[model samples]
Target: MFSLRLLLSLIMLVGIVLTVTFSSILSTRDAKHEVEELFDAQMVQTAKMLEQFYVDQLTEDQLAQLISQPILFHVDDSKIETFAEQANPNTLSYEHKLSFQLLSSTGQILAYSDSSGEQQLTTFNPGYDTRIIDRELWHVYSFFSEPHQVWIVTAQRDDVRQELVSLIISNTWRAPLIITPIMMFFMLVLTYYLFKPVKLLERHLDKRPAQDLSPINFTLPTELASTQKALNSYLLRISETMIRERRFSADAAHELKTPLAIIKLHSDGLSDVLSSQSPDVKQATLPYIEAIGEGVNRISHTVEQLLLLSRVDAIEALNKTDCKLQNIIENVINQLVHIIADYEWYIVVPKDMIINVDPFYIELVLKNIIENACKYSPTESLISIKVTQDDQQTMICVADQGCGMSDEEIALAKNRFYRVDENTSQGAGLGLSICQHIISLHHGELTFSRVQPHGLDVCIVLPRAQS
Candidate 1:
């Protein structure tokens, strides 16, 4: 999964790092250039000072002695520490890297610093130049003194400028290196807060009940205001559509009940009138009248089931009360006694078992389940009603010795109007669907399974009531 927060943070972090890196590179380059120019200026100034103050004032005899032997500034290794201590303590170590040479017009070295050695720093070119002296690279500045007719050369080792440049670059990089991670952390925190409204919207939708189409009432950022309004608009449309559908189902079923009752009454009256006719006429007409009555009854049953289904579909909450499970089961059995009389019932329910449920709906669910068992099973076949409870939940199971449904049929049993054997059963197939909806309103589960030796087991699980 790709996260928006991660993507935003990475883009911002990379942008910041690249900006800092580019800035540091440019700054290091500029600082290096300035340091080189300053050092070069110092070299030119030193060469001019040496010509104006020292060499130009030299006596003829002194010049003759310099041409005979050059004056060397080299110090003995044993006296180096004493010399260093005696010098200025604040002087930089790289000061020794700077060297100067005074050459005669004929190219004989008249005077030189110890670090410069006997060789010339550069050729007689009277300007800035670079050369390798004693295998060390140096930046050389040479000047010709017109009065003295000698060359004044000052040179500094390249490593001195390189070391200072390296120090400036390293110090420049150190700040960004330490601050980058801290910046990234803060960016991530900012991104999380910025996206918090999206997470809140998701949690609100996920926790809502299926039938809940209420508009979201959260105070979100202005950027998401349009999204919230669009979502609320869609939910309002859906809620209105469902309301129309439920009302239609209830109204259609209610409108059908009166006509079906009248038809049944007329059929019953016709059967009585046929009884007074001749034996031949009665035999011919009785079967047709009976068929008409059966059809009306089936349609009436379907209408009632449709009304109940609509009621279950529209229910968003349950009116719950603590009811005795045994009493509920007894009531369902008594209502179904006419159909269950032919079947052998084996019931196992604890006397003190209590459940928190809407009594009217739970009773309807049990009646449908037990009535289904009696309808499917053969006469004298065993039908079992078992109630079991654990710490967290209560389970009620109804098992019957009947030709059970196949796996494919059981998978789709709860769908509205889905029947395993439509020709054999006189049902509208809304019973299980209504039961499922009611149980779901109570936050419960309904499951169907095949029993051994050919039967179906229907079970419902409900959460245990809190103390």
Candidate 2:
């Protein structure tokens, strides 16, 4: 199974990493650009300062001599000069890559650094340019001195600019990389803390007993409040359903007592009549015997239907198997042989058709539907049972050629204890309800229709199960 927390954490971590990486790249690029601009500014300032000082104080020949000589300026000595080499006492680094040159208006190089060799530093365009000198790239900035009719050019090696840029970009990445682990640890902790309510809800459910269906109420974050409410509502509905079942059981028990008492009374009366041994007494005993038998059968049928209803309610899953349609219908007919003895019944079904269903429940449903057809149907009338199978569904229909019911009666027939003809004593009005529920358990539907020319047709449609 996939984990929610792991997925969420991965998304958050990846988004953070991408954001940090993009920000670092932009910052490095901006910092390098700024550093290059500052270096160029420094070069421009040096050129301007030399032009102001040298143009009035020294002739062109004097400036030429100073640039050609290239004297090393010591660190302890405080003589500031343009592109001067300052020796370091602590570090013995000797190379200074900065150099200067002076040129006349006619493009003749009047003076240049000894380290510069014979390289021309600039294009004399009064701006910055890159040029290759002695097979090494150099960054040069030139300024034309209008008053002295000469140009002062300052040049620095490209390696120095590249080294500074690398240092800036490397430092830009080092700080975030060093602290990324700590940030990620905190992020994980925060994500876990946010999901604590869900864990608590799981543990709470785990601790509850299976029979408990009470509503749950907990103080939680806004994100989880709706989930808690939905769970509570489901529990409340289950509790309501349980209450209805309990009330139905009590009603059934109360209803069974009347028939049992009638049976006992009729049995005692019949026994007394049989003991008398008179012709009239024996004649009277026949009706009493019939009454007792009818009561017993009615009570037994009611009890069986009640028990079947309760079992259907309690069953959480159905053990469906391949059952022959003809076999189940034959079994139902055999079970109802006594009741249907007076009626002409017909079974119309294919020879070897099978359906996937719980055999016991299906049989019970068949018995109830067929028994109802026998009860409401007139004696010697035709009762037709048809089982048909197609690619989409399996249908079992029980139709009776008797006095059909009204629309109102058909609508109320499925309600427990609701009888179309209350005067009839054969059923407790639970047969159709039980049948409907059993079919529903298999994810099927039960429908009632009036047969043409005066009869009732009841059908059960079940979806075809995979082989």
Candidate 3:
């Protein structure tokens, strides 16, 4: 079975096919009709010429004399031969086939032109008039001046009519053959013209880069406005959903990392401590005990953070609060002293700067961003954190002069488990999502962009709470 779209196109093509076929059949029928008309007209003219031939040669009084002549079993060929010699060759050639017969109004056969038969009565009526004719049949209306009589003549063979009908049918089929290519060309062009937007949309989709989720920028005509609007709406929704999912994943990884590190540390310490103990004496080995404990703790930590991420992803994170931004940054920095200790880092925030936010949530946001920078940056690379007061908001930016990311990598940074290079950076993909949730909670905007020359730059804009 064909698809619905394909079926519709095929139906259109079929309509064209039927139209062409109908036209061809009609032309053939008309041609056959015309051929019949011509045959009847020629037959009438032949009868008239026979009338003229008799008028030119015989006097009015001699008509009865001719009629009174004895009927014979065969024609007198000698008279016809003399007649043919006296007439023009073309007239003889044309009139040679005109059969003649004498008939009474009572349908009695009197005589025939050839006098070849007397018993067989042929069909002749005085009632012939304009009417549809059968093939090879001719109607002749004639007058005998001497007897002052009229007669109708006809022939009954179907040769000429059948030949003409065949010719018409044959000739008519050619019309469709000639017309098909033209109709097909037009149909193809029309189909393409109608489908241009859909094809273009597909091409645009195919060419899109891996991380690009921007709005479609193709032109759709006014006729397709509703369709274009629908597609655009769908695209926007998908982009938003994908962005949200990516943020959630990154935050979950970052949130679980601290607990994961602690479990691993504890497990290692337990194994070292149990290694010297008697292995044969205790069936419940201390190493296995420690391993199970660490595994359970790690799983629990990962699950709990994932749940928190899920909640933050919900709509409740939009609720804003009043808090101090500068204090949040200070708290985040102090939490990461050991991680940033050996590296050269600069903080350019003013002492008195503050902004409205959920204080604890904002602190979590700062901690995630700062800790991510500390983890990804190479040794001796400078990490810069700045808070500048804008007219209506405070702009907090954390950037590092480490390995910069392309547009694709920068956009992917917030996705869970996404690291610039996973083998080099020890991270679970949860940091940026937590920061994003905190930003959302404070009604602040957090965006990631590539800094000039190298490295990733994250910007956080929080509207100032007026004093």
Candidate 4:
């Protein structure tokens, strides 16, 4: 009934997801930065250990000879391989990959601490800033001191920084799993308090009496203020329309009762006068008395038609039965037999055209159409009634060779209280409206078309009966 609950829940759910995801990203970055800094500090200690060997004051030739040994014994040089292994200290953290390099001031690799083999060394350049080094390498060099000509480089290839960041992300996401249910539980509790007024309003509505015209009495919630205002507006409109309809029905009853009482009093006087009068006197009084009688009869008929129309409006559906479509057409034609005597009646029908509808309702629809045709048709004009059926639908059409209506007239024909000739005094202006309503009850379509050469054709379609 209210869209608030749906809209609120969606917004809260999205907010929870973004909060959890962004927090994980920030925590992972902090943990990675700290671990990378610790690894780089260990690289500085390894560079200090290499500088002690150079301080023993070995000749430049001897230092170059030791540095120039084959990086590994893969070239059949055991001397170079042994010295390479001895230069590497038995450190605590080097089981993964122990590597070091001796570099000229120009940054050429003179020796490697890895006896495994020489790795491609083309990536480094002399006098470049250390910022270009990656987190995975953890490098340190001796560029800060004088005689920057010789440099000792040391690094460990643990990949522990990336692994630490991955671990932080994995652990941080577990918070979201814990957070989701907690948020849902919090949302559930908050929503109960949030929509308290709506629930009270629902209970109030459920317990209301069928004809209750009272305004809803929900306590105003600050969160749902607009909702309460809208409900009040709708309630006021319903009350006003109900009052109007009650007055209309009461007026109709009072207006009809007065004329019926007057007609009865007049009829009684006429009956007494006729009984006591002689034959000659009776003949003179008969015409005036009969005129009064005819007036009463017309009024009674009009009142009955008006009441019947009221009943049709109040009904939601009519009784339905599958009966002969042709029979309904014949009833209308038969009632107008005298009027059509001078004119030809063309009736068409298929062998099978049964439709589901109330017989009385069908008769009412047919009577109104035929009478309208009779009044407008010229002398000796033909009227046609045809009933046709197909697998998908059934159609009933009636047409008259009369002075046909214009397009604008046809459009207004089905509206309530409308007539093609506003000045012509005749039946009440509600027949076509009732006919359209009845057809709608049967789930049918009613169409009016101007026939060629001065005529009007009205067709009604009903869904065909299933085989």
Per-residue lDDT of candidate 3, residues 1-467 (tens digit): 64444565678779878887888778877887787678667656655664566435545455455456623334223333322146554444223233454444444444454422343224443323332232224334433323435242433223445655776686677767777777777777777777788789879888664345567766777867777777779888987896688577657766776777777777677767777778763346865766677565757655655766665655333445565666777788788888888678888878766576667667767777877777667888888998888678888899987676788876777676576776665445666766665675565778888777777788888887787
By TM-score, is 3 or 4 better?
A: 4
Local distance difference test values of all predictions, in order:
0.89, 0.79, 0.63, 0.68
**Clash totals in order:** 0, 0, 14, 0
Residue by residue across 1-467, what tens digits does model 4's lDDT show? 75676568767978888888788788878877887777677666766666665524546775576566523312222332221144334332334344566666555565665422344222344222232233344333333223435566655454445655676777899879888978887887787778877888888878664345567666767766777777778888887785566456546845886878788687878778787989988888878788887667766655655666666756655788888777877786788787768777788887657888888988898888887777788878888888778888888888999988999999898886686777763556677777887887777878899999889998888888765
lDDT per residue (tens digit) for residues 1-467 in model 1: 99989999999998998999999999998999999999999999999899889997898899999999889876433322222245544553445677999998788899998877888886998899998977888999999888888889999999888878888898899999999999999999999999999999999999887778989988899989999999999999999998998899899999999999999899989988989999999999988998998899899999999998888887767899999999999998888878888888899999978899999999999999988888888899999999998999999999999999898998899998998887877979899989988888888999999999899999989999775
Model 2 CA lDDT for position 37: 94
Per-residue lDDT of candidate 2, residues 1-467 (tens digit): 97677788888778878888999899888887997898798889878887787556777677567556533333232333222346454533323467777777766676666547556788879899999978878889999988888888888877777777877787877877877777778878887898888888889899764546778777789988998888899999988888698568757866886877777776877677687788887886778687777777777767766766676666677899998888988888889888989998787899878788999989988887887788778899999888788899998899998788899988898888888877864678888887877787787889999999999999999988677
- Give Cα distance to truth, residue 159, candidate 3, Å: 2.6
Best of the candidates, lDDT: 1
TM-score for every candidate vs. truth? Answer: 0.82, 0.51, 0.46, 0.52
- The parts of candidate 4 lying over 4 Å away from their true place are 1-28, 31-35, 48-151, 155-254, 257-304, 314-322, 341-344, 351-353, 376-381, 401-412, 424-426, 449-455, 463-467
**Regarding TM-score, does 2 or 4 come out ahead?**
4
Model 4: per-residue Cα lDDT at residue 17: 85
